[model samples]
Target: MADYDLVIRHGLIVDGTGAPARQGALAVSDGRIVAVGAIDGRGETELDAEGHAVAPGFIDVHTHDDAAVIRDPRVDFKIMQGVTTDVVGNCGAGVAPANDAFRAYYAAGMGPILGESDLPWSTTAEYFAAVEAARPACNVAAYVPHGVLRYNAMGGERRPPGDAELQRMREQLDEGMRAGAIGLSTGLVYAPGAFARTDELVALAKVAASYGGIYGSHIRDESARLLEAVGEAISIGEQAGCGVQISHHKAAGAQYFGMTKQSLPLIAEARARGVDVTIDVYPYVASSSSLAAMFRLGRGAAFETAPAIIASVKYNKERYEGKYVREIAAELDLPIGEAIRKVLQDEENTPSVIMFIMDEADVRRVIADDHAMIGSDGLPSEGKPHPRLYGTMAAVLEKYVREEPLLALEEAVRKMTSLPAGKHRIAGRGILREGWQADLVIFDPATVADVATYAEPRQYSRGIDYVIVNGEVAAEHGRQTGARAGKMLRRGVAT
Candidate 1:
């Protein structure tokens, strides 16, 4: 007879290795998987997974929950969907290493996302300390924002840094890497970062690579110059010798609908050239961003464009929650872009909206790729918010796997688990094996689906029966059990 912490019996284990499922009883003790095969074991607690699929807990490799994790650390919106870990500080925006010197300029780039409160941390160490103080329900990994790193060296300057300034930027990145940040992230379409030249990015990427970190970018464009933007990312990887992850890999705009056909191959060619490259995409056809950015994307023209459907608007929250920009344009008897600008001017806070700009076929092509991984790009703290914040992982299982059979169950699990863990160099996570940490999710594959929609975005996903973080039960039977066993994971450090 063996005494263990917990054992999940009678489940089909997917294992997160892209292998075939098998019946197994997983035993956990002292925060690690002890045994994961047929066994007669007794534990202090036990769960009957019966007909559920047990796999390593999902990792949201791309997320904007950096500050949200501190404000509402329970992170129920993500945990209910089996997301055991969140990679935060994305889109060239982050909270750490920005003291009073860079706070205002950093706040301007973040817009309404940075409300009235002053940013709380001056360094990555302090940021990690705040996360520890919060006791967030899910584990967290931090990234060093390229723009914030630049801002540390040169405040709000759009021009390329001089030789001395460049060295200062590298120093900040090196500091963040040593402070436990896993990698570097950039938002090329946003200010300052958008001003960066290819050489500048490559130089900064080298600093991150020296510490075994990865590089992820919200590329310069997602529409007309989609392939060109992707090429730039590949170029950075080649010149810097770092693993690259393309964030929210999507082809937006009607004219460039199927451009993924070209973009993916360029990434493949880069891989052929020994430049390690991968991509992450959310499971939906719509994308979300600030109203000001939407207006800029529109170039102040027809809001009635085919794919510019609006999913959420915060100015007149009640009436505009579920309506599209085209509908608002018609209602006001004004041009689509004019309507967007007026709405922004009318609101005191910077408003946010969801755009239905992506093609379903494009999404299918990206998800089907062997090297691509899952990233919700979830913005739980943003206005009204897109359903992706709550439904991304669930929607993938329901729509892509069980419904249309676009991918096999084992392969889908791999994209959500081991693939991301491997790309980010997040050690010992993303797989279910002996000696690995006991981070796992058990859910009914048949019943797993997303209930959150554009109209009502804040809702828990269904079918996930049990969630374990650091070997402790964090959620059970579709609800959190008041456990905050999650820890802040740092790059190059063993868990």
Candidate 2:
């Protein structure tokens, strides 16, 4: 009998640890890597990878694919970009331990992608069980959503939690951590979670820290107040004694085009002060969010305006949807408030805007920073989605590492794999060492490129010829191999 289930021979291995690339073969047994050097052995299967680069499968640290995972387990958008694992429940939104009422509340933003029958579980544990049962195309890890937790514990009302409410929320967070959440995520720009005072977040984060969980956030603002938001996240990390991850790190809006330089220093200072602060960013300049977020500066105001905006006929103008409110108001000859309302009407109908906010120099500077990791803040539901969903990994490999030479290949791979895995405590992943899980990708760096554009968003990327998830072939020759071999990852004492 063969000593191993599979062997990939003669490939240039970039182990995702920021190490120098090596020319070698890799052996896999069961679902874990057994060897990482020359192995002249008989095997159940052999894949020739000569001249290709084999690295740890890319881990997308930030994504909004909660419903899409159930609706389409293939995860074509990410898989095509060489992503083998995606951490969902980001930006304080997810689908676990939620009832029909909660589902109805978030339907506009999350969509009705998963049917009641499709969701056979409710709690995080049960949700993972269902994911395991379904056998997805890529591994899925999740964070406990602060928005969902607050909504579940305190309903839609936004107020500082009283002693009893705070205690109850703490218990709920504790339960979620025990049930497999990697960390706690908050959306300070979105409702309920936005309503939470900084003290309440610090209190909940303390519980997460006790359980070895990190604290991540979609900050209160990505534009004018980005510096303050970063400061607040750093403060929370300090006060709660927890690691912090700033989700979809960016300085949006023309007003803050070059503010990344100013904001990133706050993160660096926090790290210098002994707080473990990190951030993730997609490759695209345009951000994706509910149309409502553009109009309302605060959470409650956005919620109040969403309905009336959807009702207006003037909102059907697609040309104005992705632009800024002031520009739209000028073009429509309407007041700023009315223009904002007109744009936010139906969440689905409201064309997801692509605000050109960040300067190219700023993008390069932030992404090149050692403390940063790659995150495709990609939402799969939008009709004309951001290209990052299908282009993130390829963009990094092709643009940053190859074309611009802003980052070395090994350094870029670290941002995509090990950095995120280490930050989130994902075990047996993000590395290509012996005894690790055999989640790997083989691609041609010279030819790898992102084909998807904002105008043509559904196109798959190029040059990623093979992707293996847990020792199973998920994508072959840039095409899905119809393998649903992914698993649900849980938090553990050691990773």
Relative to the unseen true structure, what is the C-alpha lDDT of residue 326 in candidate 2, on a scale of 0 to 100? 60
Deviation of model 1 at 24, angstroms: 0.6
Best by lDDT: 1
Once fitted onto the true fold, the runs of candidate 1 whose alpha carbons sit more than 4 angstroms away are 106-111, 114-117, 298-302, 307-316, 319-322
Give all candidate RMSDs, comma-separated.
1.9, 4.2
Instruction: Go through the candidates in order and give each one's C-alpha lDDT.
Output: 0.84, 0.79
| Candidate 2 wrong stretches, greater than 4 Å | 112-120, 298-340, 346-351, 493-495
| Distance from true location, Cα of 292 in model 2, Å | 0.8
Candidate 2's residue-wise lDDT over 20-108, tens digit each? 99999999988888999889896798888888899999999999877677667899888888899999889887777576656666654
lDDT for model 1 comes to 0.84
Model 1 Cα lDDT, one tens digit per residue, 1-495: 557899999999999999999998999999998889875769889899999999999999999888878888889988999999999988887777776767876455463553333678887888888888989999999899987877877877879999998998888788889888888899898766888999999999998899888889999999888999999998888788899999999998777899999999999998888988999999998887766765665534424565454444435666555577777777888877677766777663366667777789999999999999999987764445788889899999998999988999999999999999888877788888988989999999999999998878888999999999989999999989898887798895658
User: Which RMSD does model 2 reach against the true structure?
Assistant: 4.2
